[model samples]
Target: MTEPLIELKGVSKSFGSHKVLDNVDLTIYRGEALGIIGPSGTGKSTILRIMAGLLAPDEGEIYVQGVRRDGLIEDGGDPVGIGMVFQQAALFDSLTVEENVGFLLYQNSKLPRSRIRELVKEKLEMVGLPGITNLYPAELSGGMRKRVSFARAIMSNPDNPSETPEVLLYDEPTAGLDPIASTVIEDLIRYLQSAQGVCGTYAVVTHQDSTIRRTSDRLVFLYEGKVQWQGTVSEIDSTEHPLIRQFISGNVHGPIQVAG
Candidate 1:
């Protein structure tokens, strides 16, 4: 069998008094779309941060492509091009959408200004937000800003043509949007994962049932800072796992408790 693309072994993280993750072990394979789902604030976002090397676990280790490393994984260039679409869109209000999308290429890539702009425009069109390059983040709707963020995450570095980020990590891509906007983002996620062959592997951290059902082939449930269940999207309904059942049904009377 081929080695997994990413491995989290006995990973644990805490924020002062709050324990955010504990002994979280997850393995993500090549060319697969995986969703991490759970109740709100169950450390789903924190897990993405750890995976992106934004935060380090106090215990355990992170191994990329079966190699143990001290810092973020890097091969030919920048930290393995781990693209993360942040939960809040995280766009720069001062920059135009085009600038924000091509910021990395502008800074590190040897590609000319015109060529970089072309690439950024192409990515924007791919995300279904064509010809909005001149607008600022504040000028667009929430869903549009989120889509621009998606475009940024997938942009490759010209300096390291062979070093494009193989992994795309999304943290709540559909949160805080209306039903229609949420559907658009979910569909885009599926398109990028399945059609474009953009990234070798991608992981989504989300709470929406539609997102999990539509975008991922398999999923893992994170609860109380640890993964409690893992299964295919189809198995989610028939599983006897109490945590998963409560989560999917959004039940308040099960083993899982609603925070007051």
Candidate 2:
């Protein structure tokens, strides 16, 4: 976890005139579960997008495995594979679970349908989801859909091992789930960080307290387009940092201005 895998140096971005990230410097070290948390409009997700190379920073530089990325992912591949799990699961509504999980292999690889199906099944089972491959996204519950997305994010062609993602970026992974469901997702996040799991390094942007506390070894609190505070999960409770204190306690009378 001491080695840096991805780094954002003086990164800033804006949509129109509204600034999101302002010269924010952040890093994700290898084999670390890093959580990014803040209020709704704080650009946490934006940071994840930039990390995934889905969006180019308006200012500043992004490095993957110490090499500066020149453009968006479409321009060139990073030194290591990076995968993303979107907030909505982002599965094709018409596609079955099998299709959704194996979509990448199906589109980009010459692997046989049987091979892809086998790989899909293996991933599904890895996420504790089995025998639901024939079902559509609509047929699954919120948590089930999330697990399916997890399977998809970790999917890689056995023929091309380098294509496997070394880092995963998760955006609001447990947003709409109930308490129990949220716990399930949180558990899965930690599980995937284990040696038996596919991805050991990941950055999660989440608002759920349990998800943040359970999945993250270290956390960075984003507010007003900058990283205001950062520390280990255990340090959260002991710190008197106003922003983090206010956020954790859900106090409306703190420095955070609540939007109407």
TM-score of 2: 0.98
Which stretches in model 2 have alpha-carbon errors above 4 Å? 195-197
- Can you write out model 2's per-residue Cα lDDT over 69-182, one digit (the tens) per residue? 999999998988999999999999999999999999999999999999999999999899999999999999999999999999999988998889999999999999999999
Instruction: Show model 1 residue runs off by greater than 4 Å.
Output: 72-80
Per-candidate TM-score against the hidden true structure: 0.94, 0.98
Q: Clashes in model 2: which pairs? A: none
* Tens digit per residue, CA lDDT, model 1, 130-219: 999999999999999999999999998656756577889999899899999999999898788765537768899988888888889889
Distance from true location, Cα of 242 in model 1, Å? 1.1
**Residue 152 miss distance in model 1 (angstroms):** 0.3
Q: What lDDT does model 1 reach?
A: 0.85
lDDT of each: 0.85, 0.94
How close to the true structure is residue 181 of candidate 2, measured as C-alpha lDDT? 94
Measured over all alpha carbons after superposition, the RMSD of each candidate to the real structure, in angstroms, is: 2.0, 0.9
